[model samples]
Target: MRSGAPIPDFGEAQLRAVLDAIPARVALIDRGGRCRYANRELAEFVGLTPETALGRTVTEMLGEAAGVLLAGQGGRALDGETVRWAGWLPFHNRAERRYVQRILLPHRGADGTVDGYFIFSRDLTELVESERRLLETGAQLRGSEALSSAIVASALDAVVVMDEAGLVMEWNPAAERTFGYARHSAIGRPVAELIVPPMMRRRHVDGMRRYMETGIGTVIGHRVEVEATRADGSIFPCELAITEARLPGRRLFTAHLRDLTEQRAAAAEIEGQRTRLHHVEKLSAMGSLLAGVAHELNNPLAILLAQATLLRDQATTPELRRRAERIHAAAERSGRIVKSFLAIARQEAPRRTLVRLAAVVDAAVELTAYGARSAGIAVDVTHDPDLPPVQGDGDLLGQVVANLLVNAQQALQDRPEPRRISVWTRRAGEGAVVVVADNGGGVPADLKSRIFEPYFTTKPAGAGTGIGLAICRSIVGAHGGRVELEDVPDGGARFLVWLPCEAAVEPAEAATPDRADESLAVLVVDDEPDVAESLAEILEIQGHRVTVRESGQAALAAARRTRFDIVFADLRMPGMDGIALRRTLMAEQPQVGARTVLVTGDTVLGASTARARRDGALVLEKPFTPSDVRTALEQALMKRDPPAS
Candidate 1:
């Protein structure tokens, strides 16, 4: 045989070379379904040589089923049609062992007649098994993504997703509910414009842009509270949390929002209630102060009147005149005390003006001198000559200073040593300062801190109203100042009040001298006989015709009988109060009612002074001077026709 020629290839060398060269197993079959030729691999698989396998029917070598399948495929090829089949075939050498396979390409003659089939079979079991596993894994990944999306959709807090450019990518159902916008409307809109408040819209847009450009965030990755505008044109507060993430080539942000409107409203309501309670406590404190002031006034008035009556019965002498002058002074001091108490309890509109601090202190000291003398306390005054004036209600500040003097005197009443109260005025930085110091046992350590608190007092129950210092503090505070208690190194308590002073000097009001009073009939009504008598005497001395009635009912009856120019009636009389009497008189005799002047020593009457004024009547606070009484009587008389004889 030639070197490259086809060998008469029953030789093992040629067979082995052909088998190795073929990519697949190649076998040849005989007419009886027996193996006539086999490649090296096929022969090895069957555990037989080509010579041993030749002319051996497949049914004799392997199984009947294997033989039948081989014969059927070969017969189809022989009919001049290319045939291919794949199935499980039994191995000749292995008993009852099968291999899965596929066969390819049959051989046919050029005359269009089949000669025999050339078969190539391959094992494909592992490839089919690998494909099954891949399909299962793909299904599981899809299921996980679906479950995650479902969870996000069902959340209660508003969830919004945005692209790097701040355009809304996804808006969940919760977002729709919170922002009052439908998911469809929000999905394609810019998130900043849709959800951010108008005031914050520009900032939000800039922040998002900066974060996208430079990864510097103003709000991203942080939770914050902000106001959001809703579709209804109302604004609601909300808490927002933003988180940034990357998906593919795009950056995304997710925001979670929670509404805080109800919470904020609840907090504001609670604060309002607390403020109301504080006012109620303040009023209760005022009630106590009123009682203390009434008691303080009554004590001096009783003594002064008793002394005056005794002096009136004595023989005329310089000493007697001096004693009578002292009594009159005491009575005047008591009158001032009542007036100050009425002013504090009354919620009168402030009459603000620039006032001298030194003058106020001096007036307070003079007014409380009699009481301080009675209490055996000496008052010393220290004033800064160059102290600046303060803008405030002069009467109220004077009342504050008076209250401090009285308190200081009372605190030192029982001390064994000579008790001394000092009134000091000075300029402190840009403000005016008034200091009232007393050489009392000093404020108790436990009570010092609470001295300015309303309703807090060291005096026994029913003695002090606890509101004096509180009112003082409030008045000073209203003038843009502060009141505080400090330790007096000389073993006493010092109360210092600082008030902001006017930067420039103000011109003083021109003083007007009092004119001689024209005689006018005045009716004085009071439950206390002495109060009525004292008022009648004061009015009579002022050159006014005066008549005294002990009750509101008597005043009304007296007004009906006599055409008096003015009816001065006490407010808290029994049977009929001053308000009721005025209404009755108005209904019965309109002219007389119009001239009705309501007067009361009770501080409570201050509360209704405005209403009384609105009703076209003059209101005179009790414990007034003869001058005040004369002025009110003149005003009332001027409004009325002269009394008919």
Candidate 2:
């Protein structure tokens, strides 16, 4: 290009083309505040041709005030600073006025001094309107969070906040009361260290760490029931919820906790009362059962004993001796009845063991077989070969089966057709079932519903106590099983008992004692001379020195004086019962109190028995045999110091 000639440089044309291609309006203003050059977009934006815009000062085109505004902006641009302004500006051709943004950028000469200004203006009316809407939206969001916070604080449940570090960040008023800590005291403390029980603290910390790392949670977003400790060092139950929250730079957790102390206590109280009511009902039924059992065993025993004595006096032949043997067998059966009653009423804890269902069924059948045969009833038993062993008390289960069989036989006595009592045992899914069915006149539909209810017997006043079925139900329930009655298709009623089966357990071998000729002094205390003398006789037979006292006070006095190796005292004696006497003795000589055994006929003293057991005293029910007395005495004596001479 020539130095000062007007050259058609392709580079300048390309720049012009690029500027004209821009969507935004573009213009050029000289240092004197005159519009020197305008691009096509700017010309169209102002509704003027580029030739008309050229060499026009702002005052000549728009007026004096507009001219001064433009001149000031040009001066700012000439000072080498970009000037930007945006507002509403009127267009000559556009019907409606609109908002626009004007950017003024200074252009420099070859000497690095500002020569002119390049201005670009964009119509940003839509963008400014959108920004206004966004500002309103932000205000709404802030109001929503405030409202939510207020609602959560007003909730009845205790609210707490913790940061990702598991430190308490906020504690509400409800939380203070629930945790027995003030808000000021709880804030900034490690949440797990403060609220979690010692045993669960480490687990809670680990869970928090895991959740933070993998976004995996066990309790988050879910409500859970757990144990909580209060500031008083007392533990209580609680329901809790944890939720995750996002913060600007970290994560947080909000916990809602509800105290379940009162709920749990009320539930426990109701359960205790229910158990007590059940026990009371059981005792009432037992009273009726005692009456029935006594009635059933007494007549047979009197006949057998009387006949045996008569035959002993009048026998003259082998046939008479055979009859006497029959009398003896009958008496033995009566004795077994008494034993069963004693076992049912015994205070001893259940001895749990694995017992074969078949063995228990066979034994029970044998017990009632003679009576059923005598009543002209045919007995049938069917056992599944695949039946599994059950964990239970063998004697108690045998009693249950015996009771069921006896009830069945009694039901069929007046039946006209073939009287049949069938007992079936089979393996059920995941359990075993024992069914006792009778083909007698089926239970009256009305009576079937009440058969298992305590004291609701269908038999004539003296024949049944109505407790057998109830006891069977209780026994089955205690084993975590069920007892139900099903209707037989043809006739009669079926009682099905389902019990969980367990692997067979081998019986523990009896331990042999070392031979030692150590003699122990034993004290026997009872109000009844017969009972005291019986116990004394048994103790003496066991090679122990024995003394008898008729009252608890007397027993206490004797214990203080003699230092006996063991004291077997009747629990219900007059003037200081076993508990009071034991307490007095314990206060005086704990050693003697520890060696004491409580003997009573009343098996229904629930809390009294519980307290005695808690205090380490052995309880024995009455009507015990000589061997029973001997074993109890030996065990108690072995637990005490040697008796002084």
RMSD of 2: 35.9
Residues 198-316, candidate 1: write the lDDT tens digits.
88888887877777779888667555678988877678998676766554466667677878776466435433343434445566576667755674475346435544644544539
TM-score per candidate, chains pooled: 0.42, 0.42
Clashing pairs in 2: none
> lDDT score of model 1?
0.69
TM-score of 1: 0.42
Candidate 1 segments whose C-alpha is farther than 4 A from its true place? 1-317, 338-356, 359-378, 384-389, 393-421, 427-431, 437-474, 483-496, 502-516, 527-530, 547-562, 584-592, 605-610, 613-616, 637-645
lDDT of 2 by residue, 417-506 (tens): 688888989999989999999997777777777888865778996586567889898988888898888888899878888999996566
